[model samples]
Target: MATLKEFEDALREHGMNMALALLERLRERDRATRTVKPARRLTGQKMTPELARAILDLHATTGMTQQEIAFKVGVNQGRVNEVIKRGKWLTDDPQAPEAVARDKAKARLRGEPKPKKAAVKEKKVAPRRTNQGQLALGDL
Candidate 1:
C-alpha cells in the first residue's frame, strides 16, 4: 500500500494532469472554431451638399423632425444631425429664426450678456403676532 504522503502526491499529480488535458482540449476546440477573417472598413451613407440643404430646408419649412428627414433622405438621424451641425444653415447670413435662437442659447451658455428683464418690486409684509399679543418665534 502506498504511504499517506505518496497517495496525496499521486492525487495532486493526477488532478494537475486532468486540468492540463482539459485546457489543451479547450484550446484545440477554440482553434477549430475560430476563423481569421480580414477586417472590413465601415462605410456609412455619404451626404452631398445638395442633400444637406434639402434636409435643412425640409426641417425648417415643413417642421419635420430629424427622424422624418432622415427617412425621406435615405440616411440615419445621426447623419442628418451631423450635416445640420456642420452646414451653413445655422451660421450663414440667411440665419433662420430657430438658428438665431440656438445661437443665443449657445452664447448664453458661454456667459454672454442677454437683454435684462424688468425686475419686479417686492412688497414688505408686517410681522405676525401670537394670540397672547406677543411676537411669534418665527418673527423673532
Candidate 2:
C-alpha cells in the first residue's frame, strides 16, 4: 500500500489540492452517518436466575432505573425490563406448563442433560503495528 507521504506527494504532483477538501468532506459525511446510527446490538447472553433476582431486588428496593440495573448486571436495559415483567430470566415467551413438561420429556428421551452456562471468553487485542513493521506506541 502507498504510504500517506507517497499519497500526499502524488496529490501535489497532480495539482489536486481541491481533492483534499473533497476527502475531508467525505470523512465528515462518514462520521455523521456513524454517529446517527443506533448503538450496537446486545450480546445474546442469558441472565442467570441469581442475576434476575438481583435485578428485581434492586428495582424494588432502590427503585433503580432499568438502564442502571442493566449496567450493574452487564446486560441491556430491555433484558432488565423483561426479567422484571416476567419474574424469570427468560429469553423467550414463557411456555405453558404442559408444553414445558413435554419438552423436558423429549429431552430426557433424547438423553440430553439440562444445559449449563457457558463461560464468557475475553477478547484479546493484537498490538497495533506501523507501516514500517514496528510496534505502534500511540496505543500505549
Write the residue-wise lDDT of candidate 1 on 1-140 in tens digits.
99756755776787877756666688799999999885332343455557778888888899788988887777788868976786644334436654577678888999999978899899898787656575788987
Worst lDDT 10-window in candidate 1? 39-48
Clash count, candidate 2:
0
Candidate 2 Cα misplacement greater than 4 A, ranges:
1-45, 90-140
* Residue 27 alpha-carbon offset, candidate 2, angstroms: 7.8
Against the true structure, candidate 2 reaches a TM-score of 0.36
What is candidate 2's lDDT per residue for 21-114, written digit by digit as tens?
7776887998888855554545634566677788888999996899988887788888788788866553233484534765788899999998
All-Cα superposition RMSD per candidate: 13.5, 27.6
> Scored by CA lDDT, what does every candidate get?
0.72, 0.75
Q: Estimate each model's TM-score.
A: 0.30, 0.36
List pairs with backbone clashes in candidate 2: none
